[model samples]
Target chain A: MRIFETPLYPYERSPDQDAAAPARHPVVVVGAGPAGLAAAVDLARRDIPVVLLDENDRVSYGSRAICFAKRALEILDRLGCGDEITGDGVTWSRGRVFFRDRRIYEFDLLAEEGHRRPAFINLQQYRLEELLVRRLRDLQSEGRPVELRGGSRVTKVEPAADSVLLTVETPEGPYRLEAEWVVACDGAGSTVRRELGLEFVGQVFEDNFLIADVTMKADFPTERWFWFDPPFNRGQSALLHKQPEGLWRIDLQLGPDVDREEEQRPENVVPRLRQMLGDDVEFELEWISVYTFQCARIDRFRHGRVLFAGDAAHQVSPFGARGANSGIQDVDNLVWKLERVLRGRSPDSLLDSYDAERVPAADENILNSTRSTDFISPKSETSRLFRDAVLNLAETQPMARPLVNSGRLSLPHVVLDSPLQSPDADGLPGRTRPGSPAVDAPVDDGWLLARLGDRFQLLAVGIDVPDDEPGLEVVGLPARRHPLLDERYLGGAPGALYLLRPDQHVAARFTDYDPERIAAALRRASAQETDDS
Target chain B: MTRLRTEPNIPDGDGFYEELLELHQGRSKEESDSINARLILLLANHIGDREVLREAMKAAADTGL
Candidate 1:
């Protein structure tokens, strides 16, 4: 059987199952999806015990999320699986937008040269999960305190003042677990969120999309091709993407009122594919499903001791590939704060920054995806008129090219007005400003981000080297080492010092070397002190 | 930073108005709406100054009211 078809981590009764008292862990991740696995791996890497519970033993059944963006890949690199994923996935940066029969214009998502990873990669969700599971197993072999229990369903969640009680159901029997903190990454149909009586509040788009993953020997280049009102699917949009193997992902708009069962039938889907791909092209359907997405998120991610991450926290339409990518970002933002709080290194209130920062990120994702959805599936006649007009003008007009919204593809959202970020003191580059994730550049040995690793670091660019401070790792790089580094980090300034958070987001920056300011920013970032400025 | 000029700016105002009406003469209501949308988009792109566009949009929105 294929890896996804086989049980990778079958249910085995744990010692906690037979204990007279419920065994407690430092953290209990309620699902083994990408967010949960990343959270568990991060916790274990920090030497914190984590129990990852999942409802199934295998990876995701189908190729659910295929597009992994660069920021998500960078986060995976910190988790020790970036090279494996980028190596096994099909990388592409160019996307062509089609209006009816003719191509309107194309865009390169990432035009810069110094980045370590590409703009995006198309890998089967199962394969990505397999890689993460392999990483989890590797962590296990290293005597890390992380456990993956498959076939374990979290049936109930009860939050308390200091702990959360979970009732999990398994093949053997139902058992209880108490966790100091619980992270729910149980996907859109989240059981934990439901049990807590919380709902994702936002717009539910009125459209259906049929996804058909086909294996073929076609010679399509590795670029994203999006169609608006195509000939095959009149008055609708379609998407074609290349995957790692011979498989290709084709999404066709089925409108809002499609009969899901009939539309997903191979008889109806194959003819549509033939019309789009030409009649002589031979292919076989690998998996087929119809989905209607919602751009929504919960009110707050943190609910007392139980925190929600991934789809349980928020969800966006899959057009921009924001769903899984943002979910991975959610965990990346979450795990660091959680680890610090669990280690008694930071106050519990520091976890509140996760909500403050990520909720805005979720809102940004929702806004962008909702705009893309409205453009692709115009809600009213007036909106459709404007959308078509832009497309009509985009045929020959370069100005109209930027107006055509074929799913404003996913990019990392900067955390704006965040409390963790210190206000900009010197006029450095805005791209690497406080609250923006660190931009990767070439360093002495390898990439800049690879050296930054997953910790609080003081990056001194084009300036004199500083000795390591109490809790921050000091990294000094000369401006002459790389011109792109100077362009990205220093801009017009002579030199700069940046205090980077554990997630490699800029906490603060300065033109002069002031250890006092850097130390205060670190304290404020960890919630050890209040921001006075 | 240009403000929306409420006073006449086009040198040949009637001629431009006549030309605009002539462009929509043979079009249906839906076609006119589409053509107007395309025209607005073209003009908006040409005038890439966002503050001027914002002022023009506000002036247009408050015209009848």
Candidate 2:
């Protein structure tokens, strides 16, 4: 029996590089969307050759999904663009839910403490694409070239045993390019997913929602304003959010039966706005569009040499701002794994966990977005009654405030069982448990895990393991001078040590801190070779 | 709240609630849309406020925003 089977090929291919042809990249990314561009950036930063392709002539226009979670901000920080994006984007700290003209509920996103980053930043998607493009160009100028091919449409993808052959149709003509790996980031209706015969299953909401980007001169607060009921607009609702520019994004809910063309007429929207705000407030319409929400995911994110990221892998409703953020996170999870495999630091099986970990994250986001949609647009009488009761209870009961505020739901750090987290015999509790978002933790200069560089870290909280632990390097998190040190780590539970991935996600947690057990778990998490094996 | 429709002698209240909860959780497109339409109508009737209804309709129109 063959223990190691070669990657299955879709067609036969030559092994030798053509002497007359221009140089080919190690990785060829199709679609210059957030996911594809991010992957290219990650690879380029690691001195890897990458070629990014997109069919569009220009960056994505108008406002697409613009919200970024704190986790995604950290990824951008790793790429050296986090501060620039965060500095320019709008930070929303509060939200309000209105029932007609009356305020039903309000939320303060800043209520949580100890966050290194803000809860979210709203910036135009185009600006992000522009930033990626500029960064890619700068990297190319610095000698680590990342070839960006725009107006180049991928007409065919033929996966060989060792490489992927792509036939692209440019303005000049059709051309073929070969690479060791391919990533497809071409929106929800991904051609690559179809070509590979992957299943994308989910529900598409039937209601048509009209979004109008306009400059509004009104006295409404800068926070997110959601109206469950607005006077003069029975059976309809509206969302008003401030954008980075001196503009507001106004989303008006439309029934499924309404005609899109008639509803888009400026005459209809302007009058409705005049009624909501006084008649004298002037506004300029920048763009108007109708979008239908959908929740979907491809059955499999990887197929042979090709992988799907972003909307290609899954799509979520815009309610929770999960679409763009989740896609960016997908690339974050994939890029390091791909680099390790390419550099021979890890086996190809490391790529398998990408599907296992990210697919669940995608599913969770989809489910959350779907639940939000249902709550906002309840179908059954029972659901409506329940929602109303919850709202009413929230108004009187101060304790229930957090449950009503859904904005707090963001992606949690993944706690996988990996070799990076094996602890030593002298157990330290807080050190071994998976690390969560330290948004509220007090900053201490000497805290080992806190001060560890923004990369993968092995924290030996209590055990004095020599700096080596097989495939992992252990660093002792020194006991703090603070009185709370014992209470925080060893007091409540078994003092355990933890291994954290570069993305600040916990890979493994060990209670006993035993060297042998720690090593075994670490090897398993990283998929490294074990002595027993 | 005004009751639009009620079934008499519905067997196993917990089981029935569980099924609806599952359907809601699953969030099938057809199921959600029908539910949304019914909710809008029910709320509109309950409030008996044309202005509020109109605002909801307008909000629904601005889906992409």
Candidate 3:
């Protein structure tokens, strides 16, 4: 009995087709996945009018992208969907890695940190998209300048000098749409990317993996459990994760030369599941699919008026849960820049920093995912030998435990040497450096992240920022020395001031408050837009 | 420990070789060499043992020559 439910929304052809003149929106978002929905919601919140188009009428059917990292949840929080998501999603921050039958180590991602959100949550992608859809509808009901049109497949894209022209095919007929900027979030085989003739380049593993979501009544704890070579699943790697609603995602490694069609059959899959969980453990399959991991990304995320995001811009192996989490981060990075550019607060070239910043983020994800794939499915005999040696030594040696690579789990990547950041002076804490996402800590009655509230602010940790700056929002956190805060934010010092971007990433930090550097960084972050409004 | 126990490590050597070939699919020799150089350093750092690394070097050198 498959338990996952997918309901389709009604899709009607846009009335704009027969209008007297084509309606021009400030932003047009293609695809309604997490990335596109996130982009739409973020833009709408910024008072930008947007039209969201998707070919399909429903959320994702399967329990795809189950592990949502905290950073993504924060981004979703900003878009008004985080509380509902984290409320229902199973939260976990610890995992165990096993080599063969023996458990080598148990790792805790955040050992001791008091924050509003947990380190991670396990909810199906459909559940996530459903929540986002509800949020979009709420915004729509409130008359917030967001239009979501389903079953509108973009058939053709023409990139002009000023704007991009689109031809979308709806059930009624084909219609022309134009926008000042097009956000191509139409996923991996994106029609918009194809129309532009852009290439996605990188590594594709030859081996196939079988991912199955099953519903069962078992007492499996909600921790990511991985095995390199397990007794039950003979010689190949296996991963087990518990999603909400008693659903579990199982990934079993299928080596090269597998008959993928035969492997995916329920008869074949059920037996493998029985072997992995014992024969007596009853379960019914909800969804099953076969996939090959590829670590590929485009050279740039921005192209003229058409910007690529999510799977359209980059893709990685599902090893580290980087796929959707990084995609959400991509949306987070792009939306602010897009909003600034749309508001005329920043020049159009400010959009280029999105590419500069997120390309490196995508590359980091690709590189890590590629390494995890190589380790899990070792590419050579020598590499496998080395992997085995490390796994073997990991049992007795603590140093070898760190060397073991069982999907180095997703962490929010800090932008290294971003041109938008003000350069760091000597002796500042590394946790919240320029271009790094501000690490959260406990403030007076709530979490520090809840206090940040998604705005460009001058943050004064453990002290008060001098008043008198008109445009800057100065936040003062009292000097109460918790160990975690001291180590991460203060670095055993009393106070430090930080200039933060709207995304809560540190733009600059200093021991002494300097208004000139802060002003300079604000200008650089705005891509040299010097006019003080 | 057994000195240089050379057995099949990856389940399918040919498949893994295919992946390696695909990694360098579109790269020139120079770019591929540079990639290999970077990979060598990275893997060497991971291994971090003088004797085993020496054995690996000799085995790899002995293969092509």
| Best candidate according to lDDT | 1
Model 1 residue runs over 4 Å out of place are: A107-110, A530-533
- lDDT score of residue A53 within candidate 2: 77
* TM-score (0 to 1) for chain B of model 2: 0.50
The predicted structure with the larger DockQ, 1 or 2, is 1
| Local accuracy of candidate 3 as per-residue lDDT tens digits, A1-533 | 22224434567656788876666778999999989999999888887999999988888777479888889988887788889999989978778888887888887767455767777888999888888888988898888999899889999999877888898898888888889999999988889998999998988778889999998867766688888988766668999899888889999998888998999999998987887777778898987898876789888889999999999999898888898999899989888888888888889888888998999999999988888888898887567766777777667666667767767668898999787888785676887888898887876566677777666788887766677654568887755545555566778567778778888898888777778867776787678744546
Q: What is the TM-score of each predicted model, taking all chains together? A: 0.97, 0.78, 0.87
Best by DockQ: 1
DockQ of each: 0.91, 0.03, 0.04
Per-residue lDDT of candidate 1, residues A444-513 (tens digit): 6589999896889999987785586889889888876688899899988888999999898999999988
Candidate 3 accuracy as lDDT:
0.82
Q: For all candidates, what are the clash counts?
A: 0, 58, 0
Candidate 2 wrongly placed segments (more than 4 Å): A1-24, A218-220, A392-408, A413-432, A435-455, A460-477, A481-496, A510-518, A530-533, B1-65
CAPRI level of candidate 3: incorrect
Tell me which of candidates 1 and 3 scores higher on TM-score: 1
Top candidate by TM-score: 1
Candidate 2 per-residue lDDT over residues A26-84, each given as its tens digit: 78888887788888888888877887878764567665876777777767767767778
State chain A's TM-score for model 1: 0.98
Compare candidates 1 and 3 on DockQ and give the better one.
1
